[model samples]
Target: MKLYIVRHGQTEWNVEKRMQGWGDSPLTQTGIRDAGLLRERIKEVPFDEAWASPLKRAEQTADILVPDQQIHVHEGLKEMRLGSMEGKRQEDLHPSEKKTWQTFWEDPERFQPNGGETYGEVEKRVNGFLEDISRTSSGNVLLVTHTVVIKLLINRFEDRPLRRIWEPPYVHETCLTIVDWDGTNGKIEVSCSIDHTKAGRGW
Candidate 1:
């Protein structure tokens, strides 16, 4: 089976560099355009199943990218909950909170927000989802989700340590990542592709 994973397009919080976590934000106009462009880029791939995080940004992107397809809303695919940090810019964090935030990226399994989820917790849920999908789905599948979820999924696919998950290259808005899964084994085909975002007549 082939999995096509996508990070949702830029949202208002994304533009402001604010922590979005489980909080919701509408997509910016550029975000909508980017989603449309991404749709064109992968339209040739016949997606047999579609899934998305329940968050509006992800759901909206999935709707645009795979219209007429029933997208399964999976709570496990939602972005990591940032607790009190949601909607706050990095500079806006309190000194103590800032330290925690920094530690989170460096060692997510050990550091998490006061009431938020650890990276380990996120990995469990996402891995569970992947296992379920691999057991039941075939052909190509499209998963529209958030940045954190995308990173975690890729880390698991690559068998990388959870602590070093954040070290991977950043996932751009509406960027696509593809992986081939055969029940017990998986390999990444495309990491993050932004070719559709290029402005040209030949795109």
Candidate 2:
């Protein structure tokens, strides 16, 4: 089965550089427009099923991308819950909290958040979601989720270690990633591609 995975568009928290895990926010106008741009880019792909995180940002993107399809919300696809950091801006984190936040990006394997989750926890849910879908679905499938979830999905597909999860090619807003899953394994057909975005046009 072919999976078309897309990161949800930019949100108010995104603009503020806040930790958006589990917390909710409305999509910016740019977010909606870019999703529409992507909808045009992949308008012809025949998607057999559609899934998205229950978060409003992801749900909105799914609706824009596949207006005619039924988007099944999956709890397993939700963003990593960054407990205490949930809505806190990057620059505003306290001194000691800042160190842990830096660890989250630099040495993810050693990151022990005050209340946030470890990468391993998010991986478990991602694995469950993939297994459930692979066992029950076929043909093309569309999934809309957050950056961390999408990155974890890539880590699963490539079998990368936790330390290397934050590799290059960041998942931009509404970026499209295509993968081919043959029940047991998944091969990436495309990484994070933002060809449909305004910034991608060399502006």
Candidate 3:
């Protein structure tokens, strides 16, 4: 199974650089247009199935790309629940809090910010989602999700420092990542890509 992943398009919180953990927001007109262009790019991979976060930002993008595709919305695929920090600007936190945030970035397994969901919590749900998909699904699949979740997914197949995984790449609007999952041998190959954007002249 080639699991394709993508981040939702530009949003208001994204523009403001606010923590959009679970705070819901819709896509901008630019986001919608860019997503429409991605619909063309998605044709490159004839995905057999799709999964997405329940959030409108993600679901909307998935819907646009695969209009007739009824994707299963998985709570496990939701963004990290930010708790008290939801919607808070990066500057509002104190020096110590900021330091803790840094620590979390360094090693997510050992760090947990105040009023923040630990990476362990995220791992549980994410792993569960993948497990179910592996046991029951077939053919290539798409997952329309967030940056952090995509980072967690990558960590599953690669051996990298937590800090690097924590600092995920710039997942430009509609960017796609392909992950091959073979349940028979328990092997997976992950690759980050911007081909969708380049092919569609979305850059």
Q: All models: lDDT?
A: 0.88, 0.90, 0.77
Q: In candidate 2, what are the lDDT values of residues 1-203, reduced to their tens digit? A: 99999999899999988989999899999899999989998999999999999999999999999999999999889998887888999888889888988888999888777777788888888888988997799999999998889998888889888888899769999999999989778899999999889654555
Model 3, TM vs. native: 0.86
lDDT of 1 by residue, 28-71 (tens): 98899999999998989898999999999999999999998999
1-203 per-residue lDDT for model 3 (tens digits): 77878888878788877778888788887778777877786677777888999988999889888888788899889988876667877798678767766766676766766677787798789888888888888888999998778887777766555557755555676677776678533243435566655655645
Clashes of each: 0, 0, 0
Instruction: Name the better of 2 and 3 by TM-score.
Output: 2
Off by over 4 Å in 2: 198-203
Of the two candidates 1 and 3, the one with more favorable TM-score, higher being better, is 1
The 10 consecutive residues of candidate 3 with the worst lDDT sum are 183-192
Counting only residues 3 or more apart in sequence or on different chains, how many pairs clash (N, Cα, C under 3 Å) in candidate 2? 0
For each candidate, give its TM-score against the true structure. 0.95, 0.95, 0.86
lDDT of 2 at 109: 83
